[model samples]
Target: MADVSANPRADREENPLERQRELMELLSQETRHSIVQALLGHPKLLASSAELNHFVPSKSKKTVEEQLEVLVDAGIFALYEYPPNEDRRGLPWKFYGLTEYGADVLGDFNYLEGVPMARAVHRKTRKPEQIERHEAAPRPPLPESVRATFRLDEETD
Candidate 1:
């Protein structure tokens, strides 16, 4: 075994490079890479979850959503949801956009459309409790408080 006195941090402590490695591993997967690539070339740099599904037709809706959730959790994507329809009959539009950090990672690493490096896929195993919670959890509600208000002369939407 190597000497331990030189290192101060514990074995479990995460450093910046490790986090980036985690992200690279996440993005290296085929389905996840497709999702990122689609957004990279998009005009708005954003896409609805359903739209991302088109990029990876081989995967099911649930799989795409799961991958989107992972990206969202990793802070690589910011989710914007549209209001529910009248009577709240169906799911709201959950649009995922590339966050600034996401854009930087893509640009810096040349992961554009992927495939320069050999794929090292990563899939985290889930515990039973985690699986149950993830399946049962409701979509997170939008914030109710307004921090700032600004007027815009032009409305794109």
Candidate 2:
């Protein structure tokens, strides 16, 4: 049998998780992350480097193109030249979209599903009983004189 290590396809198949991890690591960078997110949100759409400016507004066109090329080389995206019949420009626009593998990986991209309190963290609500139980410093009782002056000691029966 041929050594799987010698074959990139066989190596990727043998450890599919590794490929996913590699994809994630590459996307950990802000530019790459933005590019992937843009593609994911607009599947099957071919976006040129100029068009991608909205997704990565902070980056220059050159920087965006460089990152797009990196994603293209990684097999996460397929790059294509704009049709020749289109209006000519200084440089031919390159369009990019997710590859089959990229789409498959994106299908499994649910890393934020378990993100705790991402939506509710800002809203005020009753503190959980667990937190009160674990609190190191219990609140001190108000002095009777101070409570009486503020009528905080008044109780309705």
RMSD of each: 13.7, 23.5
Q: Against the unseen true structure, what C-alpha lDDT does each candidate score?
A: 0.51, 0.50
What range of 10 consecutive residues in model 1 has the weakest lDDT sum? 144-153
Determine the C-alpha RMSD for candidate 1 after optimal superposition of all C-alphas. 13.7
Q: Runs in model 2 with CA error above 4 Å?
A: 1-11, 88-93, 111-157
Tens digits of lDDT, candidate 1, 1-157: 1121222223325686776677678888888887776555333344566556655678999998898877776656668654442234333345576555555566667754442222121012222443223223334332221001111122132
Candidate 2: pairs in clash? none
Q: Which residue pairs collide in model 1, if any?
A: none
Supply every candidate's count of residue pairs whose N, Cα or C atoms clash at under 3 angstroms. 0, 0
lDDT for model 2 comes to 0.50
Clash count for candidate 2 is 0
Q: In candidate 2, what are the lDDT values of residues 1-157, reduced to their tens digit?
A: 1111122334488788887687678878889887765544321244555446555778887888899878776655666554452455333345565555454455457523322232233123333444222121222233343234224346431
- TM-score, candidate 2, is 0.54
- Poorest 10 consecutive residues of model 2 by lDDT? 1-10
